[model samples]
Target: MVAPLSAWPWEHLGIFKYILYGPLAAKAWYSWMYEDNILKDLWCIHILLICTLRGLIHQLWSSYNNMFFLTRNRWIKQQGVDFKQIDDEWDWDNFIILQAMLASMASLIFPSLNTLPLWNLKGFIASLLLHVTISEPLYYWAHRFFHKPYLFNHYHSLHHSSPVPHPFTAGHATPLEHLVLCTVIGIPITGSILMGYGSTAMIYGHVLVFDFFRCLGHSNAEVVPHEVFNKLPLLRYFIYTPTYHSLHHTEMETNFCLFMPLFDALGSTLNTKSLELHKKITSNSGKNGRVPDFVFLAHVVDIMSAMHTPFALRSFASTPFCMRMFLLPFWPLTFIIMLVMWGWSKTFLFSFYNLRGRLHQTWVVPRFGFQYFLPFATKGINKHIEEAILRADRLGVKVISLAALNKNEALNGGGTLFVNKHPELKVRVVHGNTLTAAVILNEFSKDVKEVFLTGATSKLGRATALYLCRKRVRVLMLTSSTERFQKILKETPVDCQNYLVQVTKYQAAQNCKTWIVGKWITPWEQSWAPSGTHFHQFVVPPILPIRRDCTYGDLAAMRLPPDVEGLGSCEYTMERGVVHACHAGGVVHQLEGWSHHEVGAIDVDRIDLVWEAALKHGLKPVSSVNN
Candidate 1:
């Protein structure tokens, strides 16, 4: 009779021990004999060595090969990745230490799992095949189970946190989830041992192969050569590329297999976004060379208001019963935390396209109601501004301007918080208040001798009022507090004082030809002005609705003349003649290519500079008399 199949040479001897062991053993012996006594502790030394080597390889792959991988087979047409939020969550050094400790503990508990001198080629191949087949199904179900509402919020959410996954982030899961994954990975090795097909070389080799694929799946960069899939189409069915796994992270609905797309295709759970994104990135589009010109950050007031809703009805309706119960009692705390987190996080709104001048693109980031109230919640507002600046840096935007109350709130050091926290960012933060003052002042012409100005106590309001007074135009200032009005009067120039008229009531300036509403004045109060009056609104969330008879205009930045090279649309109506001065200030800096322009105080000197810049770009006031 023929010998048992297990007695074959190929099944009993492997390359790792028979061929490569001499050099590895010699090095270990030398270290223990002379280099370091610590090497005598074989288990400790081996674990530390393996962890260090793995870390170095991971770092090198992540830093150097990432771009090469992406460019070779890109899935997205983006220039940079936003990993700032992920960095905040995971500390790499701590993670490395923890991983090393865990490996050491595992080796101590199951010493038989340690790498040995046994070599079995047949066993290695069989064990690897078993591991792949068994683990694929086990991982698929476990991954899908984690997506269920009950476990997702508590555990799996951590792994899904990084939308743009990096290689190191593959293992950034919660303790419970990590344990479950480790158990799944061990099933094939255990099975091979029970079937008398396991060897030390096979087990260790399986771990190495498994980790290699795990890192590749989360690399966020596609390295599969285009020719491979084209010439050998069958390989695509067997191998899941980085692009395939990235879709699972982004879409979060499909592509649940660990190693191959077999299970996903079999279950009809594969996502098409991966293929679509790949096609788009590889297509010969005209926008291949274009880059972002500017980035803006703005907040959504409605979303902030919705967060404080009682019972979290929106959140509860979206989750399963288990998560709903888990989230019930913490409603009040959740609301408060949401309120507090507003100052710490930023939400990217959209990108601005077709802007005027050489600068043709811009990005808008919303701070979620940070601009609603001014000066009252100063600390929280400043924190939000700082976060936006850092986010801009992450997006590779070199210059960022605060809009509306953001400019006013951070007027203290001209965004010192951003500058201090992110000194290495190479980004400039501007309040853009100077251009705002300029655009509003430009509204007043020689035809108007007198004007009504509300919100004079505010920074922009006060600056606009003083600018009008300096122009020798009569100014009627309306404010809530008489004491503050008197205090401002003391700082007014003697000649300007002649033009300044203090009034506590809206009716006091009804007869004025022009009215500048620079604060949150109500519709009723705005209606109190004369029927044919011209209203120049400089406040955010403009209090007055557009009227048919009355001409309502906003302070705006002027666009470059059509004759200028690379001129894009100003994205504002020419009927208004100008855009918000704050916006114009940003445009001016973009034109001048200055990366560190600050318009904090909006002093007369800064205002003159912006006014000159606006004129150079062909920006001027519209005819207010016609209104």
Candidate 2:
């Protein structure tokens, strides 16, 4: 019969006591015996207190004070730890620092046997040296192995999950991987002790040195002096400078050596060459490889894959059983007759006209003209067109009919080549024959807000403005020419003057209250009208400062309060940064090959002002719907 598990005294008296506990206890007892004879009562008491209470008490007190102060203080920002800073305070968020703290605690709690038959000061120092030499090489090789794709995905990917590395990301890896590294330090020290190093000094030296180096390597500050490191002969080989370890964090694959440079030199994985290559590649996108034709095609494939695929077409002869059973009685003959008529119409007349249109309409001059045409005919302009649609989406605008003028503004002439080529851009080619500016404006000006005018603006800009103002639609005119603005103003109605704003020319800023410019506002002295206020925000948010200037008259006329919210709930403030236009040629790539009346930039604020005026006059934002 077997004894009950809990009631078994023999199991409790396991081999652990004889094998592990007895050796450790006997070492401690022997050390205590030497202490009792060599030292008096007070000296023994001091040794006991220093070994047991000093380090633990200090760590505990500091932890409590830091926690208490951080929680209670509202204005005190989190001062993140830096490696270079000797007084760099550690927070619980620093996982590496926490691990080091734990190692320190373990070292303190388990006192080393000071004097033993096998132990000596020389042996203890050697054990400490061996621990660093052995443990660091092991870590370097293991880390390099983890960077291999398969191992990276399983073990090291977690460490790099944070795109912006913070103190918290350090030591954040799989538990199994973490345990493997932690165990390595212990193995080296234990082996040294077995090889006759004094256990007490070996254990204490290992913990203190390991923790110090570990914390220093993980520090954020540039504490390791560059001048000193460059001057140091072979010291850099033994000590991991701050920059050496930082390069590891920045570029993961190559800089695997930690605390020693031997592994890096041996494996030829040192990253100085890789970093220089990275800089060159980033500076010039084409430096690494040629921009392949398939790159854009790959993007298109990604977009298509994200969307659901349509089912394959069914064969003509294989009608489903349900279709045959349900429709055979009366609808079969009816369906066949209708299908034949549709096919006949499509084949004879409709297809002929479609082919004719394709031949005449599908060739147009490129948007930037012939000399500097966008290289990739399909994708270069296409991507910008999609981005334009996205820009419209952000401002709650809708795109409707796009009209392009024929060659020499002739009626019943060939369709505009530009509109015909990219039919997917949604433009309607119009023959601008005998139709007056008023007539064209009266027809399409009802619902359109923005007009992207490409060709010579004979009556296009003025007509669009008149029509939109009559219907209370905001107008944004895009033009490369300034003369077009003068011609439009001459023909525009007196009432329409308030509706149209020219963004390009210098004088237009004085005439139009709401002025826009393609160039950076601050570059030209005249561009800053003493009237309008400037509003600026970061190209990227949060940390970057924003700057803009406005005239007192402009602010007063615009009726904005002195203090207003600029961006993301921040106070409307200005900094001393220059406002430059992003002068990329593909600025409005997506809207190319479209007419002026079809596109415009809408300042939603100006639209709101227009809506307010309409409201004051007791009319809704949409006039036709309200009526």
Candidate 3:
């Protein structure tokens, strides 16, 4: 059980907790319809409006800061926000929700706020003074107070749990802490109103600015320019930088001021290295770009997937991709993006992380999956992939893995074209299929005698058939072409040739319990398998689960090593901290420090070798995604 001090009263409600505010929203809507002057209902409405606006501000800052591409070099914490931190700060806006209730109650108790003028210049000026003299010092002292043992253990530690603070982390606090924060924040607005001059504009402006600064400070990236601080050296004393507050989290003993560094200086608690480190970080921003040890070359699946990128909408990207009612409105925008990027696009960095000590980043090809099918788009896609390879080679990237459609044999011969075109290229271009085949073939235990196969002539399928034949495990290769079957059969040893049986139709495997689907199979096609058949796939856009009795495995993926840091976004539909096997394959290549390019045909001999390397480096098979 959670301690009373750490748990909120509504913690058990989960996402359903929003139902608490449903009545208030309905009341506001009802009042708007009936009331002639809606200003009378502004208090009720403002609560919802401020909550929505504040959430958006926090989200925008988070999206920018957490998108590894934008803040790669400037990250305050050189680590990915893990599942632990994400869950801890999941409901970061609970403070605002509680404040909505408190503010509504305060309005009922005091009627003067409802009748205030549209704009009060005196109140605006007073709000500034009140925040400077009152909110700042009070928050500073209260923040300092929480750092002491007892309160720190219970309340403040919740906020501090996220060492690398995202903007949402600004509000990830215990109820007691938020209550104190609400008081500190409310002081200026309440003070200005009681001074008999507070107005509508003053209330909105002060609160929004407070939220803006808070979000900006915890952005986890140095967005404030060093040039600005250099120009006005004294401005550093008045306004705090993200780096300044970051030290407070890392160092934990100094820079206690809320929005200003003035109190930290007066309190004699400013970190000595704060300004120097801030300058070093901000001055070097974009001077020389980050070079990764490994690069995962990826592409968007469709227009909908374009909106699901890390930088697009962070909260959305954090979860598994699926259709949401909220995303319906953004379809037109993403469609426009697909059109605009189709012709004039180049590969760009998407996300990054550090594993052990190696830097790994994902770079995206601008082409969507459908476009790769278009004859016109194949050349353009290959061009982008080539440009990315050249960039990686120039940056001394040790290994670059081609993912999904980006490495399709038809488009660029599984990246062999690029490797051949640039023969002197130092970077090892990997299609990662050797490990992919290992992951698929390993799915069948030693007890399994035979298995059904689809798309048997494809590279991964061919490699699987050859590997299994060596083990004397019969492979019912599904292919109509005698030439392709004989070619693959010849590759296997003379003794194992009988184990590779060529079948032209799905009905050949009616008694087979293991169905290794390497091609798209519809409901009618899937019906050929017996009830207990498990589908192990290497197919893109994994086939749908149609039969209730038969189970479906996730796409080939590996849980990244526990030591892997800063992997924030889920790769496609894989879970957090889990990556596609191909991605893990490239990481293994780099870890093993292999010099050769892993492209074109799958290397059947190295299947077990790569799997062992992956296992050695702590990458575990995530064959069952339910795990």
Best by TM-score: 3
lDDT of each: 0.59, 0.35, 0.86
Residue pairs that clash (backbone atoms under 3 angstroms), model 3: 79-566, 80-566
Strongest candidate by lDDT? 3
Candidate 3, residue 596: CA error in Å? 0.6
Tens-place lDDT per residue, model 1, 1-627, is 422221222222432323323344465567777865533445555655655565655555454323321242353323223224334333322333444556566666766544443666777766767766787888888888989986787777777876556666775666566656667666776677656666756656666667778777776556665457679877766788777887887777799988888788877888867555544544533233343455544443443232322113312212222222444566676567566645545543232333453333333333445444555666766766676677666656656776665655434455555666666876667767777777677766668899898878777777777777788888888877878777767777886788888888988977875988877777677767778888887776556565666787754545434433322112222222233456567766766677665744457656878778767876554433344
Q: How well does candidate 1 match the true structure in TM-score terms?
A: 0.46
Provide TM-scores for the models.
0.46, 0.31, 0.95
* C-alpha RMSD between model 3 and the true structure: 2.2
How large an RMSD does model 1 have?
19.8
Model 3 agreement with the true structure over 74-94: per-residue lDDT tens digits: 876766676667777888888
By summed lDDT, which 10 consecutive residues of candidate 1 come out lowest? 309-318
Give the C-alpha miss distance for residue 383 in model 1, angstroms. Answer: 2.8
- Candidate 2 per-residue C-alpha lDDT over 1-627 given as tens digits, one digit per residue, 9 for 90 to 100: 422221212223433322322333444466567766632222233233333333343333223222211221211111311121111111212333223344444445543433433346766666657656787678888888878887677656656553322222343455545555567666666676567655554455565555455545544333344345447656656666544565676777676875787678778877765334333323443222211110000011111111111011111111111223333453454445434633432211000001111111011111222211324443433433334333333423322111121122231112233344445443222222212222223223334454322222433334445455556554555455668666665655676666665554444333333322222233353343434422211111112112244421100001111121110100012111100111000111112222332122122223333333323332221112223
lDDT of 2: 0.35
Candidate 3 residues lying further than 4 Å off, grouped into runs, are 1-6, 34-37, 313-315, 337-344, 624-627
